[model samples]
Target: MSENILDIKDLRTSFFVEGNEIKAVDGVTFQVPKGKTLGIVGESGSGKSISALSVLQLIDDPGKIVGGSIRFKDEELTTAKTSRMRNIRGNEISMIFQEPMTSLNPVYTIGQQLREAYKIHQGLGKKEGTKRSIEMLELVGIPSPEKRVDQYPYELSGGMRQRVMIAMALACKPELLIADEPTTALDVTIQAQILELIKNLQEEIGMSVVMITHDLGVVAETCDYVAVMYCGKVVEFADVETLFENPRHPYTVGLLSSLPRHDIDQDELVPIKGNVPAPDEMPSGCRFAPRCPHASAICSELPELETQEDGNDVRCWIYTEQWDGEKGVKVYDNETTS
Candidate 1:
């Protein structure tokens, strides 16, 4: 049996918006091993968050899992009932959302929220659960945790609130944690601190993590593997070092190039040429063809992700001998990988 904690295959999440069906996660496949972090990188509409939510079957009304299999701890989560899902959600797979303010109930004190969360999974008495919550707060680096536990979310700084959120997520000591843009709302220093806190906690608890973010820098600093998403599909999948050093998919290249570089010339930021395509109106062909610097005639016909010799997977015709971005050439008569 594999040591992986999470495995998703051909997962597709959709939503009903304006009387039309929209595909948020289209055939996403990946695995997260115990004690490892898999960074899912993409723009806002690339379906990274929805994919994570699908694993826990948290897609609310109007949004649904239309197709796929989600496996956690070798158990299939795709068809699991709500009661079964409840057991997995906090106890086996906790989530740290992007915004801390909305996640925590403002009506409750910090201690009350944490105690309730811990008690649900631990089945411990209120006193023991409260004690565990305070210990977790301290473990996450909150100063004078005993005192801080009595404070409200508004009393804490942005960084501190984020830490509390992390602590709450870890209170259950889950086997998997899905962090969706946990640091995007904070400043750089706070972002660093949160990332460090997550890394340290991951090491201590040995839980597999799914880190979803648009920032490539975060993925580079913390993740072991990367899945670069574009228009609801994973366009590039590779090991961290390989993806960073040798990204082949045009969308992945665009993302990496757009980052501001002090070492490079100010004019050299290679921003992605187009915004994310609308869900319903996604192009019939390659979704990123319009923006891809390497796009060609064959790109108008769509491209399938092709596996390469180096274990890097790319979904561009340029790499698959169908089109050449440079010199405007088309080599293949008709080629597709399904």
Candidate 2:
């Protein structure tokens, strides 16, 4: 059997707002193995959320997938019609959004929502669905789930609500789980709890997870592999250890250097030189060249993201040209100016 559970190939998603085309996700490619976590980390507007939405075919309104393929369990989802897409949405690929409060139905009781999730996907009888709902609540670490299941969304704490969302997503035992900034809205303590719970659950069930976040600490803690995105493009990708220990791309290095982790001294946080470029007017050449220190004449021509030796990959001319291999050549390591 193939180890890869999800393969996204060169996906490009765009939206038309007032007759203007805004490409939100551009040429993102990555693979997630069964029972492992692949973290997509970048700042806001880097296209992390949009890429996850594209996988589920849920990008609404003016947004649409413009190109490339999304393969789940060897099935192509890129061009699948709405009717067929419905069969896969929550059944095969479940998603947990960043804001569980807004995502949950505030008007409905928690039991009603969870039972609907179970009934819709599993086609269980009312009593069976109710039973399963309680089990799900318990699974997500909600205490006294039997009682909590009957409570409304407003009655539960923020952490509990997020847990409910995860429970609903897990009700069908989906082969893959897509979590979009799952902890951004929660407090520090709750964030740790939610992340820990997700990791533990993935370990027990052997489900592939695509955890999307801007938090490098979260990626370092849970993800086995990671893709660093910037301005709708994946600038670097490699296993978690390799990415943190030896980031190859300038953008990736900038992101790692700026992380608010203790290993990186508080005074040593080197912020990226420029803001995330807007989608409408992206820079030519390397999308990051204006802010890249190692950028030279060659940087005026875009570099392709290609596989390096030992299964690592990067999209910077530094790796393509000058690295002798003892240490990665980081252009933005100190966030210098040319």
Candidate 3:
């Protein structure tokens, strides 16, 4: 068996609008090792959520997985039949979507929603499914699971609703779990709790996790490996330790520089200059070259995601021998605005 539970290569998901194609996830590739967490970190419109959605073949009308291989447990997901996908989703793999308030059906009770997974995946009857649902709720640290199960989604607090979402995703003991911005609107204490809960649950279930988030703090706390995405592409991929200690891509460095560090006293956070480009207005060359301070003539041509000697993958011209710029260029100097 392969060590990677999920492997995506050259993924290209796009939305066809009025005579225009918006490449949301363009030529993306990454892997999630079994029993470990991989963090897909980036700002908004980086295609983190789209990539996760493509894994479940959940792209709606006007949007599609146009190209690339999505292999889950060596099974080709892109070509998998609807029936096969139905069996796989929430059975072997499950996802906790971004907003719990909207993700959960308001009409359905918590137990009804949770029970659906058990019923569909395990062939459990209503009584058995309800029993399992309550257990899952309790497992996720939701107090008064028996009572909460019968309550509607709106009845629960934001944190509680988020817990319910987690419970539903884990009801079938899925081999892989994709958590998309699980801590988005929650407070700091709730965020910490949610992250801790996920880590504990991952340890207990022995499931590989793909954590999609913009928060670097969450990545540092939970990720084993990190893939930094920017404007629909992965600019840098490395182990969490290596990524934190030494980020290779200029985009990655800019992201790190934007974060406020307690260890070092800084006057203010260094925000990355310029917003992400529109899908249609994407740069022909390196996507980040427009905002990169080190961009030069070589950067005008796109760079491949090449592997370095240290096993880190970076999609930048600075690491290549063809870099015509000055030798030993420091990416994180205080002077560079970007």
Per-residue lDDT tens digits for candidate 1, residues 1-338, read 67888888889999988898898998888878778999998888888888988988889989999998988877889999889998887888989887777778777889998988777767778889878888888766678999998999988887778888888897787888899988777778767777887888788979788999877778888898888888888888898988766667767766766764222244455566768877756888898876765667787887777788987777778776656467644322111100
Query: Sorted on TM-score, highest at the top, how do the candidates line up?
Result: 3, 2, 1
Off by over 4 Å in 3: 118-135, 138-144, 260-267, 333-338
In angstroms, how far off is 118's CA in candidate 1?
4.0
* Candidate 2 lDDT by residue in tens digits, 1-338: 56789988899999999989888888888989889999998888889999998998989989999999988877889988888888888888899987788789988999999888878878988899999888777766778989998889999988789888988888877889999988776678767777777777787878889999878878888899999898888889899988877678878878877766533445566687877777666887788988876667777777788899969778877777643333554444332321
lDDT of 2: 0.82
TM-scores, all models, native as reference: 0.87, 0.88, 0.91
Q: State model 3's lDDT.
A: 0.88
Kindly give the stretch of ten consecutive residues in candidate 2 with the minimal lDDT sum.
329-338
- Model 3: ten consecutive residues of lowest lDDT: 259-268
Best by lDDT: 3
Per-candidate local distance difference test: 0.80, 0.82, 0.88
